[model samples]
Target chain A: MRYEEFKEGIRDGIPICLGYISVSVAFGMTAVLSGIPVWAAVLISLTNVTSAGQFAGINLLVAQGTYLELALTTLIINIRYFLMSLSVSQKVEENMGMGKRLATAFGITDEIFAVSMQRKKRLSAPYMAGLILTPVLGWTGGTLIGATATSLMPPILSASLGIALYGMFIAIIIPPARIHRSVLYAVLLAVAASCCFYYLPGLKKLSGGWSIIIITVAVSALMAWKFPVSPEDEEDE
Target chain B: MEQIRIGYLLGGIAVMAAVTYIIRMLPMAIFRKKIDNVFIQSFLYYVPYTVLGAMTFPAIFYSTQSVPPAAAGCAAAVVLAYRGKGLLIVAVGAAAAVFAVQLLMNIIIV
Candidate 1:
């Protein structure tokens, strides 16, 4: 890649990196508090790069969750990425090869996609590559710091750091929820499902992983099928 | 035995990386042809929002041992977000509300 391209990628990736750092620190702290070894926590963050799935998976692992349970749960939570990937495919150059496409897929997180989609032109491979690599490093780096320093940081500070993850989630969800009526419905449905899962009998005992997957897919699919985004609205982007 | 455990952990990481790569890579690889299907395209657009809502809403209220605080916080955040507050403001506001509510709950319960 040319130096200019590399520089551009770094420029585009900085905000994403900052966001990842805050979110990953919370993940690391939660993992440590749950009694997982710090290194294990770091490894999970590095590999998963997913906030909800990793959090749910860790809870299951702590409870001695089965492999099937873990897989199903993570799948449910991450089902959204499948859609995100499909949307991103539209932005990729028409002639882009499979290898580059696959590489780009690894970096297709919510923030990265938001930034990428906003671009006026087709996305470049090097720029996407840079976007993916920087955030991965930031997340892993944040996890490492949080895990290694769990004991060193005071309790209040760790508690505050935990808030960072919630902050990041709010950042992601609120923007779209405000602008789109359908998104608002999806959020409400998810909140209601969570309440039902927490309060209702039998469902209360359902694994966290499964709960996330089920609630997400069922509600999302129902909404998509029933009230599709109109074609006229599509041109708003 | 310790060495074997380490091997297993590394093995897990490797496996996860490969699976993740494949999941992200397949569409880019297999569907080199344009996806002209309107239904499929629409499904792709709306699905991410649903997934995000699913992942996030639950966390707002449920964790090891609290509910009211998170619920209130989420409510506050939702209102603020709807009002067109920037992301940082909405998040900080929600988390702060949660923290404050939790403190109140602790006082009342005690």
Candidate 2:
């Protein structure tokens, strides 16, 4: 039974694995361009297994920001995983032991969590292991390829690829923004607040990491109070 | 460009990895019931989008070697994304747009 579920998990993870390669390739290139070495970039992907949080963390690393900023930014950006973990915990087999829970939770990325949550039956440890392993391989492997390839690429091509991360960010928020007015409002407000942080005289002094945290917190709180999301208001993605 | 010391990078990676693990593990290990707070739930629901929005803009405008191609790429991404294109399509399409613009500008300038 465990073997069969593990096979099923691997099958379900295939699409996610394919999707992660492209994003992680972008991540790898971005990290290399930011002066991170190839092996370190791969290490970041292997260990973190996150997208936005890694990107934000890497930016802070490049800036040589204090460790406090790194920790706080990671906490705020990845807090959504807490919600997914809670939901997935309910779906997991009853009385799952701490070791299995800890092992499975380490792989609770947005994609992994989403796919795991869709299963009708309780998630088995082996299934979770298979599911998590496939994508981590893709993510880390893609990063390795991209980071090593960066030195070979021409300046023009590398420059063009610079926007890939932002493009993915757009892809993430736009579909939801279209579905819900409140999401759109929250995103727009966040953008405006971000601009204030960037262009305003005094605010411009705030570091990029802090600005993101402040803007994300204030804008999200305002939206939560003003237009509380209904249970049905979740994004399809 | 400044060289990133391996030690600092490793430390930063450790911090990020640790925080990520703790966030994911705590609820699964401890929480047996759903979070019943509407405000917290709503806040979590919007956090990802809000954070992405803040990070993408302004930064995206300066992603490329210059602003014009970056703007072109951003516009292409928004249009394709708004049309419900997949993530790969939007991302590659934006890069393609930036490349095309840069190529065109190179030809014109020459």
Candidate 1 per-residue lDDT over residues A1-237, each given as its tens digit: 456665677776675676577667777888878867778888887777777667776776666555566666666556556656767887688887777887788887766775565455577787788777888899899888877776555443344334434555566666677687877787778768867886789898876656766776677677768766655465464
Residue B100 lDDT in model 2?
98
> Which ranges of candidate 2 are over 4 A from the true structure?
A1-41, A49-101, A104-135, A146-150, A232-237, B1-16, B27-32
Native contact fraction per model: 0.35, 0.81
| Whole-model lDDT, model 1 | 0.66
Best by lDDT: 2
lDDT of 1 at A79: 59
Candidate 2: tens digits of C-alpha lDDT, residues B31-97:
7554567887787677777777888878999988899999999999999999998766888899999
Q: Chain B in candidate 1 has what TM-score?
A: 0.79
Top-DockQ structure, candidate number: 2
Q: TM-score (0 to 1) for chain A, all models?
A: 0.70, 0.67
- For model 2, report DockQ: 0.54
Worst 10 residues of 1 chain A by lDDT: A155-164
Which candidate tops TM-score?
1
Task: Provide C-alpha RMSD values for all models, in order.
Answer: 4.5, 5.3
lDDT of 2 by residue, A1-237 (tens): 889989988887775676677668778988999888888899989999998889998899999998999999898778767766766776677767779999999999766765675465778888998999898999999889878886455779878877876887787788878977888999999999988899999999877766887887798889989999765554243
